[model samples]
Target: MKKMSKLEAVLWNIAFPGFSQLLMGHYIKGVLFVVLEFVMNVNSRFNQAIMYSFLGEIEKAEMVINYQWLMFYPCVYLFSMWDGYRSAMPADEKYSFLPFVFCAYFVTVGLMVSPKVTIFQVHPGPVFLPMLFLIPGLLIGFFIKFLLAAKLYTK
Candidate 1:
């Protein structure tokens, strides 16, 4: 199999969690990611929620979403992106996992609050709300990673 570029890996993983792994020839792990993602998608009623949300049926979308199953999504999804990106890199970069980890954490928090939280009186629903949280998560994670690296190097 041809090695995927880091961007290719991340984008593929974004499309589906394990595509990059499969492209990179980590068959077992790739299959596992796909399976896990499928299971979560099914149990969470994610697709149904997405459809309803897109149709402007916010209440129905909220009603259909299974928060328990949905909560696991951010962790699995972000982990796959991080793993794919990390695997594609020729050299290991320390603290790289922090951004993904924090993103997952913030996304999960966003999911928890999606039902009640709104910005400027507008509800972004389950999907968009969590996505909005991703920015702060990434920023905080990268900032922390940078500080950690600086501290380690300056010592």
Candidate 2:
């Protein structure tokens, strides 16, 4: 089987968790991710929250959201992307996992602060707020990875 590009794998995973794994022929892992995504989405009422959040019904979105289940989303989603990217790359060109690590951390922090944060006098709501925070997370991850790579190469 022909190998996929890292970007392609990441994009496929973004469309739906496990898709990249499926393309990579990791059937069991892919199925598990898909099933978990479905279960978590249903239990968390994520779609409803997204709808309410988009409609600017912050309170309604919060009310319908299941925080417990919702918390699992960032980790799973980011991990899938990381795993996909890692799988697609050549072994010797392996990248650090710092990006995924920081993304999960920052996303969780975003979730925690989402209720209290307001950007530009507007509440970002749950869905969008975490996404916004992801930018900073990615930046931090890249910086750390750079530092680590520099240190390693200097040795």
The segments of candidate 1 whose C-alpha lies over 4 angstroms from its true place after superposition are none
**True lDDT of residue 113, candidate 2:** 89
Compose the digit string of candidate 2's lDDT tens values, residues 68-154.
899999999889899888988887653468988898889988988898998889888788899998999999999999988888789
Q: Report the poorest 10 consecutive residues by lDDT, candidate 1.
A: 88-97
TM-score of each: 0.95, 0.95
What is the alpha-carbon lDDT of model 1 when measured against the actual structure? Answer: 0.94
lDDT of 2: 0.89
lDDT of 1 by residue, 1-155 (tens): 76878899999999999999999999999999999999999999999999998898888999999999999999999999999999987785789889999999999999999998989988989988998999999999999999999999998
Total clashing pairs for each candidate: 0, 0
- lDDT of candidate 2 at residue 49, scale 0 to 100: 97
Q: What is the Å distance of residue 75 in model 1 from its true position?
A: 0.5
